[model samples]
Target: MRKDLFNLGPVFGYFFRKNDPNRPTNFNLRTMHFINKLSLAMFLVGFLVLLYRWFIR
Candidate 1:
């Protein structure tokens, strides 16, 4: 958490740079996209594992 914030500092800086206000800048957009995909994958994997366990029981 704290480490993530530290890592995201430069990312947020670039995200807030001038010339882009309405949408996230390129770096921020890419970072967010990657994070979203990763989280979704993790959620699906966990859900599948839970479903398998429930069916077995």
Candidate 2:
């Protein structure tokens, strides 16, 4: 469970890979993926901020 929580494979795949030729595209799916990417990016930013504060303090 902990390993799964930390796994970044799907995150990298979603952000870096070319679009799947065989995958179905729809408005709902696009919205979901966009939201996921947005959230991940926000999380990374927050983490970086915390790390910076830790080192500065």
Candidate 3:
């Protein structure tokens, strides 16, 4: 519900947690996850740049 939609705990967890033993991983899945993490990192960098510009202006 609303809490689930707004929750950031899982997002931070995904960045920090160790891989699960029972989960299956493959080349494709690993590549996709890497792309996702990279995109998120890029987005965060862009957002911070915008914020810095706003504050410095």
Question: For candidate 3, lDDT tens digit of each residue in 1-57?
Answer: 576888899898877889998999999999999998999999999999999999987
Model 1: per-residue Cα lDDT over 1-57, one tens digit each? 465655756655553555546665688877886787678678879999999999987
Ranking 1 against 2 by lDDT, winner? 2
Candidate with maximal lDDT: 3
Q: Model 1 segments beyond 4 Å from truth?
A: 1-25
Task: Give me the displacement of residue 47 in model 1, in angstroms.
Answer: 0.2
Model 2: pairs clashing at backbone N, Cα or C within 3 Å: none
- My TM-score estimates for the predictions, one after another, are 0.53, 0.78, 0.86
**Candidate 2, residue 29: lDDT:** 96
Best by TM-score: 3
Model 2 misplaced regions, further than 4 Å = 1-7
Would you list the rank order by TM-score, best first? 3, 2, 1
Summed backbone clashes in each candidate are 0, 0, 0
| lDDT comparison, 2 vs 3, better candidate | 3
Candidate 2 lDDT over 7-37, as tens digits, reads 8798688799888889999999999989988
Top-down lDDT ranking: 3, 2, 1
True-structure Cα RMSD, model 1: 8.7
